[model samples]
Target chain A: MDTAAQPDTAPAENLSAKVYADLKMKLIVGQLRPAETLSIRTLAEEYGVSAMPVREALRQLASEDSLIGAAKKAYRVPDLTPSEAANLFFIRAILEGAAAEIAAENVRAKDIKFLEKLVQDMDTAWQNQDAVQFLLVNFKFHSRIYSLTGNSALQSMIESLYARTGPWLAHGITELVTIDSWMGDHPAIIGALRNRDAALARKLVEEDARWGVDLYRARS
Target chain B: MDTAAQPDTAPAENLSAKVYADLKMKLIVGQLRPAETLSIRTLAEEYGVSAMPVREALRQLASEDSLIGAAKKAYRVPDLTPSEAANLFFIRAILEGAAAEIAAENVRAKDIKFLEKLVQDMDTAWQNQDAVQFLLVNFKFHSRIYSLTGNSALQSMIESLYARTGPWLAHGITELVTIDSWMGDHPAIIGALRNRDAALARKLVEEDARWGVDLYRARS
Candidate 1:
C-alpha cells in the first residue's frame, strides 16, 4: 500500500489516490490547521499536480468527516469544540488502550529495542523543540506498537482518529503545553510493554492518550 | 443525517445517497453475505436506478472498507479470518464497554424504560426466530444506550465495526446457533444501567460484546 513501491497505473487515478494518502498523513500529523480552507487550486499548485485530483481527495476525506465540504466550494478541516474534542480522546483512550493491551501480548525483545529508539528520537525532537518533527516521530512511535497487534483494521481506525486530532494537537502544543509533557508517559508505557504487563500497558497507554483532552481544555 | 426527512436534491445525487444509506443499513443488519460479490448491474436493477449511481455508491462503500473493489469488477464484502474476526470483537469489547459505562452516568429513568422496551423487542424477535429482525433490533438496543453518551464519534466507530461483522453474524446465527444465546446477556446489561452501576454496565457490555468472537469461532 506504500505508493512509492506500487506498480504504475493510470496517471490521473494514481494522482488522486496519492493526493488522498498525502493529505490524510498531513491531516494526521497536523500539517494542516483546523478550520483551514483547502482550495483545490491551491493544493494542486502546492503539490505540483492538477486540481482535479486535489478535488477528488478532498471529497473523499470529507466523506470520512475529516473535512467539511459543500457543492462547488473548498473543503475545510473540521474544527472540534471543547466537548467534541474531549469525546474524541475518550474514544481513543479505549481503542488505543485496547491496542496496547494486545500489543503487549505480542511484544518481543527486538520490538522493545525498536520502540526504545523511537522514544529516544522523540525525546530528541522534543529537546530541539521541533514540534512538527516531534509530531511525526511520535506518530511512528505509537504506530510501531499498534502494528504489533497485527490488526490492520484497528490501526486504520486509530489512524483516522489522528486526522481529527492532528491539527488541534499541532496547534495546541505550541501555545498551551510543552511537547515533553505529552512525551512524559511514553517511557513508562515502554517499560510496561517490556515487562509484558498487558494490563499495565493498557493503563499507561490510556493515561498517555488522556493528554489530548487536557490539551483541548488548556486551549479552551 | 437522516436521509428520509431531508429535502430532495438532484435526482442523481439523491439516488446515490439513498443507495449508499440503504446498503449501509443492509450491511449492518446482516442482510448481506460476507465475501459476497455484488454486481452493479444487478443492484441497479434491484434498486431500479441507473448503474452509474449504483457504481458510485459501491465505490464509496469500498473506500470505507465495508466492501472490497477493483477496477472493472464487482465489489465483495470483506471475509475476515478467524483471528481477524476475534480482534474485531476484542476492539468492540473495549469500545462498547466504554460506551456503556458512560451511558450509565447519563442514563435517565425514561432512558431505562426505552432500553427495556428494546430488550423486550429483541426478545420477541428471538421468540419468532427472526434472525434478521433480531440483528436489526439488537443494533437499536445497543445504539439507544450508546446515543446516551452523546458521543457521535464513538457511535460512528461502533457502527462501522458492525459493517464488518454483520454479514458474518447474519450467516452464523442462522446456521451455528440460535438468537437466544446472544440475547441472554441483554437483560443483565439493562439491570446494570437501571441501577446506574457504571462499572457493572461496562463489565456486562464487554461480556456481551465478546459474544462476537464466540459466534465467529462456532462457525469456524
Candidate 2:
C-alpha cells in the first residue's frame, strides 16, 4: 500500500558524462579553481547533453577527492588546507625521490633519449606560450622516468598523486613566461641518470619537486 | 525509435552495490578464490536482494581490479599474477616502511600501549582458532600504525594495496598458522618506535613485511 513512498526509484541515464570529463580535464589543467561550483544544468546546456552523465562523473570525481560532496549540496572543487598540502609534499618527496633513484638505476639509453627530446619539446612550447603542449610534454617526461622504475604500482601511485596536484602545477606553468632556468634542471637530471648515479638523480628530482612546490605556493 | 539498441537507457539504482560490498569483504577475507565466479542471480538470492546491487557491486569491484568484468558476461575474481603481487609488495614496502618511520617519530606512548594490546588480542584469537577475528585484529593493528603517520593519502594508498592482497594473505594466514612468529614481529617494530629511532623503526617494518611476503610465497 505504501509503494508510492518508495525513495529508491531508478536514476535516469546520464548524457552529460562528456561534459564531466572535459570539466575534469579543465580542473586538472587549472582552468577551474578550488571551490569552483560547476552547475550541472549550465554544463548540460553548454555540452548539448542531459545532466545525468555529468552527475555520475561528479560522483566519481568526488570519490577521488577532486570534488567535495556534502549533504543536500552541489559538489564543489576541493580546497587543500595547509596541513594537507604539507603532507602531500612529504609523500611526493618520498615516492618521487624513490622513483628517481630507481629510474636512474634502471634507465635505458632509449629512455634517456626520449626524455631529452621531451625537454627540447618543452623549450619550443615555452617559447610559443603553448601551455597545453608544455603541460603534456612535462607529464610525459616525468612519466617516462617513472615507468623506467619498472614498478607499475609505484608508477600508478605517483601518477595519482601528480594528478591531484595538476591544477597547482598547471597554474605555475601558465604564469611563467619563460622557464629557461626551470627547463635547465631537466637536462641535469637526465645527465645524472646517464652517468648511472642514482643518488644524484634522486637529489635532483627532489630538488626540482621542492622548487616547484615553493614556486607554486609563492605564486598562489 | 532506434534508441532501444542503445546501452544503459538510464543508470540503474539497484541493490547490487550491497551485494558487491558483502562479496568484497568475503573476498578480502579469502572466502573467494582467484578465478572464482558466482552466478549473479544466485548471489542476489543468497544475499536477499535483487540482482541490481550485485551488478553494480561487480562493476565497482572490477574498477578496483579485484574483480574482472565483461559486458553481459559473468564476472571473475582476478588471479594474482606473480608480477602484480611483486609490484604490490614493492609499493607497500616503500610506503609502509616510511609510515613506520613516521609513526615512530609521532606515535604516542598510549598508541604503543594500544598496539601492544592488539598484539595480545591476535594471540588469543589465534589460540581459539578464530581465523576471522585474527585477520580482523591484524588489519586493525597495521591500520593503527598508518593512522599514526597522519598522512591520509599515504594511508589510503596503503590500504588499497592491502585490499588487493587480502584474499591471498587470508589464505596464507589460515594454512601457515605461524601466528606467534608473525605477532612476534610487531613488538620489535613497536620497540623501535618507543626508542624514537626512525631509521631503525623503518628497517624493522621492512624486515617484518619481507618475512610475511616470504611466507606467502612459500605457501604458493
Candidate 3:
C-alpha cells in the first residue's frame, strides 16, 4: 500500500508509460490486493506524478482486465472468484502445456542449465521460507520455457494469463509455502525437456498448472 | 471505412460502452483492415459522439491486441505478419481444441442441433459464394461449441483470440471461398460432439484451426 514512487527520472512524455509499467508490475507480482479500490489521486501522489499519468495507467489496466473500472476515474483490482480462477487454470494448462511441448523440441542444453539453476534458486527460497522470492523464481522458470518457442506473441499471451493469476497466487503464497511437495513435477518436466519428450513435457506442465488450481481451491 | 454511427439511441453514459462494443464487433467480423489507422477525432465525428468515448474504445481494443497503439492518441489494427499469425493459429488450436474436448463431454442434444443448423447455413453460404456469411457462420459454429464448455473465461479468451485473427480471416475470405473444402473437419467435429467423442472432437477442432491458418498463409 505504501508503494511510493521514487523521484521521476523518466522523460516527461514517458511519465504515463512509466506509471503504467510500474502499476502493471505491482498487479503481476500480487503486491496489489484483489478488490482493492485505487484512486487516481492517491496513486498519483504515491507515484510522485500528477493525476494525468495515473488516470491513463488505470485506464490501460482496466482495459486489460487487470483492473476493473468502477465509477468515473475510479478503478479496482478484480476480486478473485473461484470460477474465474478455475477458468484461468484451465487456460494456463492449455497455453503452458503448448509452450512446454514446443520448448521440449527446441530446448537447448544451456536452457536446461538455466532452468535447473532457477529450480535450485527456488529450492533455496523454499528452504529460507522466502515465499516472494520463490514465487518470482517460479515465474521465471516457466517463462523461460515459454520463451523457447521463439514466439513473442505466444509469450505475451501466456504472460497476460500469468498476470491475471498472479494476484491470486500471491494471496495464496502462505498455502503454497505449507505444501511440502510444491513443484513436484518440475524436475520431471525438466527431464522431459532434456530428453526432448514433447508429449511428456506438455502433460507435466498441464498437470502442474492443474495442481496450482487445486492448491488455490483448497486454500480458498 | 465509412462505419458511421447511426444515432445515439443508447443512454448517454453508455456511449463509450456502445462505441467499445461496436468497434469490437467490427474487429471480430473483420470489417476493419489490418494496419488501418484509426483516429479518435474521425471516429468521434463518425460515431456522433465526443472524442472521449472513441479514445476509450481504441484503448480497449489496443489492450486486447486487436489494435496497435501508434502515437499518443492514434491507433491502428495490427498488421498481419506470418509468424504472428502462425503463433495465433497454434494458440487458437490449443484453446479451441480444449474447448471442443470439454464441450464434447457437456454438450446437450440441442447444442448439436444448433451447430448442425449453423453448418447447413454455412454450406448454403458456401454454395452461394457468400464469403462474408460463410465466415460469420464459421465463427458462430465454433463459438457455439466453445460455449458448450460452460466456461465464460474460456469463451472470453477464445473470443479475444478471434478478435485478433478476424481481420486476417476476413481479408482471406476470398481465398477461403475459392478453396473447395473450406470446413472439411467441421462435420467430423459435429459428429464427435454428437457421439461425445472428446478426443476426436479435440483433434478435429485443432485441425480445423490449423487449416484456417494454412488458408491465411496461402492467401496472404
* TM values, all candidates: 0.88, 0.81, 0.87
Off by over 4 Å in 1: A1-14, A40-56, A70-73, A177-179, B1-16, B41-56, B177-179
Q: Per-residue lDDT tens digits of candidate 3, residues B1-220?
A: 3542222123325566678767766676677788888999989999898988787777767756889875575688888787788888888898899999999999998988898898898899888876556666787888899988887667767777877888887777754546766566788888999899999999989988897678876665
Q: Worst ten-residue run, lDDT, model 2 chain B? A: B1-10
Task: Look at candidate 1 and tell me the lDDT of residue B166.
Answer: 80
List clashing residue pairs in candidate 1.
Answer: none
Candidate order (TM-score) = 1, 3, 2
lDDT of 1 by residue, A1-220 (tens): 2222112212334576777777877777777888899898988888888886677677668767788777657789988887887877887788888889889999999988888898888888878877777777777778888889998888878877877888888888777654347766888899999888999999988887788887767555
Ordered from best to worst lDDT, the candidate numbers read: 1, 3, 2
Better of 2 and 3 by lDDT: 3
Residue pairs in candidate 2 whose N, alpha carbon or C atoms collide under 3 angstroms: A13-B10, A14-A52, A14-A53, B15-B53, B16-B52, B16-B53, B16-B54, B17-B53
Structure candidate 3, residue pairs in collision:
none
Question: In order, what lDDT does every prediction score?
Answer: 0.79, 0.69, 0.78
**DockQ of each candidate's interface versus the true one?**
0.49, 0.24, 0.52
Quick one: best DockQ, which candidate?
3
Better candidate number, 2 or 3, judged by TM-score: 3
